[model samples]
Target: MTEQVYACIDGSVSTRTVCDYAAWASQRLSTSLTLLHVLDKESYPVAADYSGNIGLGSQEQLLKQLAALDEERAKLAIQHGLHMLEAARERVKSDGVANAGCMQRHGDLVDCIVEQQGDMRVLVMGKQGAGETHPGRQVGTHLESVIRTLHRPILVSTGTFKAPERVLFAFDGSQTSRKGIERLVSSPLLTGLQIDILLVGADTVEHKEQVKWAANTLTAAGFNVPNTAIRAGEVDEVIQHYCQQEKMDLLVMGAYGHSRIRQFLVGSTTTSMITKSTIPLLILR
Candidate 1:
């Protein structure tokens, strides 16, 4: 069966961008796409006791007005959620992606979505939303934790909506990267995709052998691969330049799963790709 993709919708411009990308992936990977939007009320904390204990038992007019206003606010939020779901569903359908649907569930948004991550192959979400990122997260809220929590790949968007033409696959020969590359090789979604396989490290003889192992494997699998190896500069900087030069549309990378990875975000390479790339990124954990 084709893998399933879960994408979050927040009724922002970026959400539309994310939806388009997800629909494309769904069609490309031959997978199902779930458009999820959560009505979050529990995550955001509110003031409970303001300035001592304010009694409300005796106030007739004040209590009634407050209750009415609260209900109005809730209705408005629900209305917004409905409109967002409909618009997103239309976008997904227009993209020609099948097996797609809209969801307007409730609860802590991240928590609700995270609950569904177990069965999903990837989670696509925007870097920012509704004029701000999620609270207590990275520059793009929920991205860091989402990556950390899920074993699946999480694609952090650049807010750019376009079909991917070229992909930069960062190679380290790590086990995680091994699985990532294997997925690429086995999947038909990348049948004719152009990949710029980047091998970055010291220009030592041993590293060249590592690259050979990767190249030979990919060549055997029938991929049109162009390669580059740079022994200088940071990983992020090198990737940015390559993206500009090659006009890379997406970045394919592996997730961090080791302690050596802790010194850098979940995985230094994954974090670097998200922070630096001017294009969208697809991570495989």
Candidate 2:
């Protein structure tokens, strides 16, 4: 059976690019891609303005008109969202992916993305959407929340579709890192790609040992992942530096490893990577 990939879109300009990249990945891996659009119910306001010149009797009619307008506006949003996703699915179908689909729902976007992410090998999305995405200066917090909450690998499409000729895997000797290595080794999505298995903070004894084991496992599985290490200040910085130096097409790493939910939320390395990487980073949880 083919693996499943779920992607979330806000119908932005990057929506097509994100879907194309997802299609590329699905084709590469022979996975089914599900395109999802989530309309946050929170985007709609519940309260109404009652004060008007025609005071008592017309108030009921005015409220009804207001409700109708809101309903129409909401329906338009849903239709627009579906249009973009359907177009993406059509494109994927044209490219010979038989199992591509488009789904739209009304709820919390982050929560919906996480729920759809269940049982999916990868979750593909844009870096950020044009909305009330808080902390929206450089990198939006909504993307970060999705990355941190969903325990699936996330592929954030920053720009155009580029087949990942070279992939960089951050080897940190964590359980998450091991899972990433296993996915890289076993998944058809990554086959025939030149990989750079980088173990940052390999200055520690445990880190070196884990890297050695990981490298051997990868090699034995028929993947030629060249191993390298660089002592670093912050882990994310090290990853960025190495990825930049190698001109890597994609960076794959674990989202978090054995951390409490609170710590995961507060001190998330995953967020750092999503916010900082020059190229696209595929984060596995």
Candidate 3:
């Protein structure tokens, strides 16, 4: 399958940010961009039961009217989606991405993403969706589900996009972190950017060695490694502090456990970072 950067736009306030970030990633990876809009199935119900409520003729007429209304709403939604995609395409083109593709699918967001994962090199989405207005938790309803189901790297836009110059990788000497480092080395997404490694654990020799190995790998892969720090504190607190103190633009980390039970028992760092961080995140799987 052809590899392309997929930017999911839902007409939210963050749609423009998602487009900008997607364009940046596509340019860095030297790939084409596709602006995707999914019309959620639950947003428009198909049928309503009116059996035994009215006379047979009236019920039939009411059902027809309701069905017609639903169809009309669906058509309007499709038109809105197409307009959104076109606007997104133009936005990316203005950002130096010419001839970007546009796609519109009708289904659950996660299902649509899973179906289209074969051609996805990277997925870009906003931290919140269209319906999520309350600021209780800063994650979209479908974002977690998509992250668990899709295997590609996800670049989540937390706010307006700025060209990333300094990136911070939250590494913990685990197999997932090692794999994330290897993937970073192989991919051109973060090439020529200054990377700082942060490990939130004991300041022991083993932890220091882990940080060194990550730094060495990145440096060998032509990435500029400026600093590597092993600090002792809460995992989320330390990482958040480091990101703010060092003025890092992007946070790169490996996706945590896929098991729901594991996540329930021990909260996931990946999810926590996604929820609290103000900067964008690149989650590698």
Candidate 4:
């Protein structure tokens, strides 16, 4: 089971950006790249049930026609997925990752990811999927679910692609945040980049200590952590303003571990960052 960077390409507006980030990660990690396209059941549902007694013979005919239509639709979907994979492969290859693999699966996106995660080092995907039409601030329906389901790191790409020279690590004094820092240090993806450790909350002793620890860990691991700050403000607001002011290209943080009710009450910092941040996000779990 070789580790590979999996890039989910669904022919969305962000597909190219996803490919770019995935290629960047693959090159940085010195791993193979796999372009994955999942034919989700929700995207291509089965034919509707025409079982209502509108006359058995007519109903049977209608059912058969609908089934045939469904079959055709399935074929088209498969072809489209293959094309997407091929295009993604070409893009990644042009980005200096040669011999990239391609995969197409039929099932839920999360289920496919689970099945394929054994070989996955990291997953790069679009923040907005193909089904998203409204465009602004709307994330893909599967973005949160996929992030929650997979234990691996996920790089959510938005806007266009840059080399990510500067990264912002949104750190806190939690176990999860510490684990995120550990994982980030273990990987070579952000090795040569400048990362700023940020603790957005009270500027208390604990927060300051956490920021110090994160900076020290990164520094010990040979990372160029230029700045560490402990700000007193809302999590999302501080991170957003910091990213904009600092011109950070990538934002790294731990996945939100709160329950649904708690998230509803206080709002999810993870979702808020994903939705609001103009830069790409690297979420660790």
Candidate 5:
């Protein structure tokens, strides 16, 4: 079975940006694109908060009315989801993706992804969704959960989509980072784009050697790999500053570099960097 790129389309302002990025990826990788819209079951709940001193018949009537309202809301939700999916499919198709398709699922977004994990080569979604109170202010509520649950590479879109001409790879010699480097070399997603290998904080001899080895590996695979090591300031801060100063198109890194305890209590570098980034992030696990 051929792998397809699944682009999640919430009715957020960022939905179009996600579709643009998905189209770019689909064209580059020569893969089919699927625009997925998931109508969250939890979003529509029957209201039954009738604790007044009313008669039993009145209470029953209220319950029936509430159930009817819930049914109407559910129908509207499904219609909205279908409309969103159709719009996303047309947007991606107009953006140069020839084989774009759409799917509408009724459940949690993460559950839907789990059901379609086998054929998924990559997952694309907006960092923030329409349900968010503030736009582009924080990460989407489902973003972290989807990353933790799914093993495929995820592309988190932040702003308008531009074809990436240069990409920054954050390498720290961990198993996940090594896997990211290998993916970069083998995958057609980042092929033909200039790459920069960066190592932040505690630039020891071992760190330098690791950076050198990574650069050589990428160079041997016919990539324009430039290397840099920084031994100052916080890791996320340094990386964000460098990426902004250089105007990089994308930030690539491994997800969850530290232990689970630290990640749960104090947040990981992956989340921090993504929160501070203005460009899109291509995360590998």
Candidate 6:
């Protein structure tokens, strides 16, 4: 089975951007694009909670009415989901993706992705979804869980879509970082693109050696590679500043290296980077 690029949609403002990014990726990788819309059962409106002293007949009639209303709402949600999928499919096709398709699933987004993981080459999704109340503040509720569950490359779309010409890889000398570098070197994703390997807050000889080793590996693989070490303030701030200053097209990094307990107590660099990044982020696990 040929691997396909999957784009998860939620009918948000970011959904269009996700579709655009997926189209760009599908075109670049020479793969089919699948636009997925999962109607989360939990998000559906439930009957109102009634807790008043009322007659038995009245309560039963009210319950029947609420049940009917809930059924109607569910049907409308399905119709809306199908409509979103169709619009996304047309948008991708209009963007010049030849093999574009869409699927409307009835379950949680993470569950749907897990079930379809075997055929997925890469997953593309927005940082925030439709129901996000805060304007520019929190990451999507499902983003972290999806990242934790899937061991594949997830491209988290930020602002808009632009074909990446220069890419930045955040290296911290961890095993996850090494795996990310290995995947980039082995895949055609970054071939012929200018790549910079950045090591932040570590100006020591050991850190420089690690950065040099990574650069050499990529260089041997025929990529235009450069290595830089910054003894800067904070790792996430430094990386974000460098990307902004240099106008980097894409940011690549490993996700969640610390143990679950440590990550919960100290927070995660991966999560911080994703929340702070302005360009698209390719997260490897």
User: In the order shown, what is each candidate's alpha-carbon RMSD?
Assistant: 4.0, 3.9, 2.9, 2.9, 3.3, 3.5
Taking the tens digit of each residue's C-alpha lDDT, what string does model 4 give over 177-214?
Answer: 78778888888999989999988777788778878999
Candidate 2: list runs displaced more than 4 Å.
1-3, 44-56, 94-99, 132-137, 202-205, 259-271
Clashing pairs in 6: none
Candidate 3: how large is its RMSD?
2.9
Q: Write the per-residue lDDT of candidate 6 for residues 1-285, one digit (tens) a residue.
A: 889899998988789889998998887788899999888868965444544534577577777677778878888988998899888988898899866888888778799899998999899999888888664456887888888888778999988778899898888776657777889988777789999888775488888787888899899999998546545566678888989888899988776566321242135655666777889988776
Model 5 lDDT tens row, 1-285: 889999999899899999999999898899999999888767744343554634677577877677678778888888888888888888998999866888888778799988988999999989886787667767777887888888788999987889999898877776657767888889889888899888765768887887888888888999887646545566677778889887899988776567321252135554566667899988775
lDDT of 6: 0.80
Clashing pairs in 3: none
Candidate 2's residue-wise lDDT over 1-285, tens digit each?
Answer: 445888777766567667777888887777688888787777743334444534567577777787678878887877777787778788667766767877888778788877765558788888767563532224656777786678777888875667788888777776666877888787777788777777755377787788888888888888877656646566667777888888899987665666222243336555666667656768676
Global Cα lDDT for candidate 4:
0.84
* Separate clash counts for every candidate: 0, 0, 0, 0, 0, 0
lDDT of each: 0.70, 0.72, 0.84, 0.84, 0.80, 0.80
Runs with alpha carbons beyond 4 Å of true place in candidate 5: 45-56, 256-271
**How well is each residue in 1-285 modelled by candidate 3, as lDDT tens digits?**
679999999998889999999999999999999999999889855444555555766468877777678778888889988999989999999999998999988878899998888989999999888888854256777888887778889999977789999999888887667888999999999999999998887899998988999999999889999999988887678888998999999988776654321242135555676777889988775
- Arranged by TM-score, best first: 3, 4, 5, 6, 2, 1
Which regions of candidate 3 fall more than 4 Å away from where they truly are?
46-55, 135-137, 256-272
Indicate the TM-score of model 1.
0.85
Query: In candidate 3, where is summed lDDT lowest over 10 consecutive residues?
Result: 258-267
TM-score of every candidate relative to the true structure: 0.85, 0.85, 0.92, 0.91, 0.90, 0.88
Q: Return the lDDT, model 3, position 121.
A: 95
Question: Candidate 6: where is the Cα deviation over 4 Å?
Answer: 45-56, 256-271
